[model samples]
Target: MTLAPQPYLNTRVSAMSERLLTSDQIAALCELSLPDLAERFGLEALLDEQLDRRTKSRAVKQALINTLLDELRVLIRPMNATEAGLVLAWGRKYALFNLKTLLRGQLYELDQSEISANLYELPAHVRLPQQELFRAEGVLELLRKLEQGPYSLIARQGREVFEQKREPFALEAALDQRYYGEMVRRLLQVSNQDGNELKQLLGAVLDRVGLLWLLRFRFSYGLSPSETYYQLVPSVRLLHRDRLLRLVNLETFDEILAALPEPLTSRLAGSTSLMEVQRRLGGHVTDEARRTLANGQSGVARALAYLILREHGVLALFSIVQGQLLGLPRELIEIAVEVSEPNCPADSLADAA
Candidate 1:
């Protein structure tokens, strides 16, 4: 008989969770000066800690992203093959962002140096051949090269958009749909107890993303209902396939919101705009992540939850830091941070319900 893989010893992750800021702590940090904020977070060591506002802001932002990647390295170190693969694939989302940047740079014939300056280096496993991709003669060739890589699913979707001569907006939507679809499939294949817990949190996130994207593409961008349906991530959460299809066909935002299923129907009730729904879902995801980090099994599940929440903390800090650098008022910075790191009152909702 085949032996089972050992569960991860997630002690480091549990300890690391304590390092993330509480919501109150984040709000408190918003009151600090930029220099004080950087020092409080111990971000001085990550970058040059420069004097120029623009340069310092970029360094701080890069430091935040780099910290996430460093933590990700530690988290992915002890997982079994499947679990590691899933986490590593999650990391590739960054690579896709770089891919789009590179594609646009090439398409518009932007200076190579300018494009190169914008690219981030993901770890080797997730890193595509950037130099080779950059050398490709045209957008079609870039897609062709991407098709030969591990991210062929998303690349194929991009290629189809190119072939059809769709707008850049449509191409981006197609690539995102494929990327999230593959992730949902991977999450479904993970059968461990911890996997199930992680899936509940991640599935909720996917639901939010898919619903938000559906609303934007259908109503905001004026895509037809069928076009909107085709653009959505393949979701199996609160907003599953049939639910999303029903949503796309609805004539207006209120109609779709009214038709929304259980928890969402409750959570997003009386929300005036897509932005409100997004903020409400942001809080919902934050609540689920915090609960998971506190109470879930100590393994990849908790580790991933910690990373998710940590990213939120970083975003809140990043926004405050940038706002202060720009000398924005306390009120505007608070507003931005609230939207960035929304937290809701504790409530009972069935996982994967």
Candidate 2:
């Protein structure tokens, strides 16, 4: 008989529930510079203490990225099947993102060494040296290796785009939309329970991600309706593809905001930039998770909440560290960080209904 995996995920969920940082901790974090903040709060210690390196202050930019990868892998290592699946899904997306980064970085003739340094390595893949990556022979070979994995479709699409002398942005968008769309479909199909708050929270994230992509691609990147519509990953049922297409086709951002649905519209419409909109969207999603967890949806809510909490904490740490190294003001970092972390009321109404 095959041995069963340990049930320690529940124990971990309980532990995480306790450490869900208080509002005071967030306020304190908001007040400190990257270095001082890390040292004072032991954020620096997470790097040196947890991972055993100082994560040099001046190199905080790269260090933040590396630490995040390491920390996330550590967290995911012990999770149960469902819990691990959630993390794995997000990880695959980031891996896809890194692939896009490599393609763009190489195509733009960025230094091979610098490009290699920026890549995020998953436990599955072998790392490549930066110095040799620029040479066409090595780039193709790396892509060949990556092509054998989950990214085969994207690698194929990228090749076509490369041949056509077109940017891979559209292809990237399509891959994201397809992946998330499938995920949402699978989750809903498997979950017969109508009141699953975990599904609701995940749906909210999907909708927001789609909304952000639609808004950003349409406004910032100038994607047409077909392009924007085809690239959306609808992990949630809230958004209608037709509606998204219509919004992107609108003449102005104000008009687009005016047509948005309740709560989301109100939160996102206030932002003059995509970054601001993303911040509000992320906060609302976290709030939804907290609400779900409060209403007795332990397994799913616990899973979603943990992911949100981890992402928010790690990303904030990354931002502050990067901001300080860049000499950006604390205020700027705070504003930027807000996009990823929100100050939600811990006692908000439950989402079980």
Candidate 3:
């Protein structure tokens, strides 16, 4: 189904985009103490009613995420089903996150309450079967339950990967591959200008994800070329199947970087560490989203651009809160909050929360 541009929705998204937090504002907020932060951000009521000061970082982060989701829900509420579907497609990432959490928690035998506590309370229309997932006895049982749901394909793939390797990384990687693949497939079904713009944005995202996965799997996880290739999302922009095969076969990170396409090579220059690579890629994505929001004609594209910015803002805040909770230096906190880096290590502030 084609999702035509809705002028009213586009205008509303543009207005909402204007209200998003600036990097400087986020930086300044990061410097404040919990009470000061609440007062400064006008979140005192939310803080007092929903969050404990002792675990302020997690509480504040979740509250911000919920606020973002609520805003997106309102923005899309007036649109027709097809237009709403286009916007909600982006939010599927959150559903995937919840599924991954449930699967991992089940695999590790974590308590259902603990898993549920970490899951986001998505809008009713987009919500997943959290209760059913939480009640599953094991990963196999969870997969069995999900096989007939929206996440059926991913569940099946994750189950296959788990059976083959019994490794969480492989399972998670498979889920990610499935998520991006489905995103691209769905975008292709929309034959319109907005669809093309969104495809470009998603293409860049896929490239970044592929590069990061390649580096981590080869260098960090010590996976072989074949194994690394197995984890990658099939052919996107910069790293198409041929290039990916070539890069995976490369011996060192330097060689792999050298083999990259022009824009990425230039963008990633001097990114000596994994964190640096992630930081640069995050900057690229942020810039792309802003460009789309400014120039995009389609309502879905503009709304998606706003959603990207909003999600990044929330993530930046999360990083700042994490740094603060960990008693990190202000300079370090600023660096962490400057970009929207995802899949942070388990020891990060967000994880602890």
Pick the TM-score winner: 1
If scored against the real structure, what TM-score would every candidate get?
0.89, 0.73, 0.87
Whole-model alpha-carbon lDDT for candidate 3: 0.75
Q: On a 0 to 100 scale, what is the lDDT of residue 60 in model 3?
A: 66
Better of 1 and 3 by lDDT: 1
**lDDT tens digits, residues 22-114, model 3?**
877886777687557667655554356554544566566667867777887987777656557656766777888888888778778887778
Ranking by TM-score: 1, 3, 2
Pairs clashing within candidate 3: none
- Local distance difference test, each candidate: 0.77, 0.58, 0.75
How well does candidate 2 score on lDDT at residue 134?
46
The list of candidate 1 runs beyond 4 A from truth reads 1-8, 45-52, 339-353
- Model 1 worst lDDT window (10 residues): 344-353
Model 2 has how many clashing residue pairs? 1
lDDT score, candidate 1, position 65: 80
